[model samples]
Target: MEFVRLLLLFLHLLGMGMLVAMFFVQRRAGADAPLNKGWLHAAALQLLTGVALVGLAPLTDQEYDHAKIGVKLLVLVVIAGLVAMNVSKPKPATWLTPTLAALVVVNTGIAVFWT
Candidate 1:
């Protein structure tokens, strides 16, 4: 159970990194390029690993603040929503990438400092 928890945490962190990287990737693709699908993929990964971690907490004898988890989940949902809404478009709005990046940073800060 400990190993499983750690593994999920590792993947969750990786997903966060992927999102951060997508910011750079999107920028490099130029303003006219469509939003990258990687944003959705990374967000999905984060969502899944996050849920699994919380759902398995009892079995792992871990205690978590439900309120904090709820906030993080909400933030992730917003990120995913934004990406889904714009991914199929020819080009994302000028505010999209930076907004997403800021959300990601905000989520990280919540996870680190909310305790």
Candidate 2:
């Protein structure tokens, strides 16, 4: 169980790192490029690992603040929604990358500090 938890945590952190990396990657793609599909993939990874961690808490003899988890989930949902909506466009909005990056940072802050 501990190993499972650690694995999930590792994947979650990787998802966060992917999001951070995507920010820079998107920037370097130029103003006319489509939003990368990597954004959706990373958001999905974060979402799945996050929910699995929460779902396995009892089995792992762990506990979490429900309100904090809820808030983080909400933020992640927003990030995923933004990505899903824009992933197919010819060119993303100028504000989209920054907004997504800010949301990602906000979500990470919540996870780290909301204990």
Residue range 1-115, candidate 2, lDDT tens digits: 9999999999999999999999999999988889999999999999999999999999889899999999999999999999999999999999999999999999989988887
Candidate 2's C-alpha runs over 4 A off are none
Off by over 4 Å in 1: none
Candidate 1: residue 69 lDDT (0-100)? 96
Structural similarity to truth (TM-score) of each candidate: 0.98, 0.98
Give Cα-based local distance difference scores for all models.
0.97, 0.95
Give the distance in Å from residue 3's predicted Cα in candidate 1 to where it truly belongs. Answer: 0.4
| lDDT agreement of model 2 with the native | 0.95
lDDT of 1 by residue, 1-115 (tens): 8999999999999999999999999999998999999999999999999999999999989999999999999999999999999999998899999999999999999999999
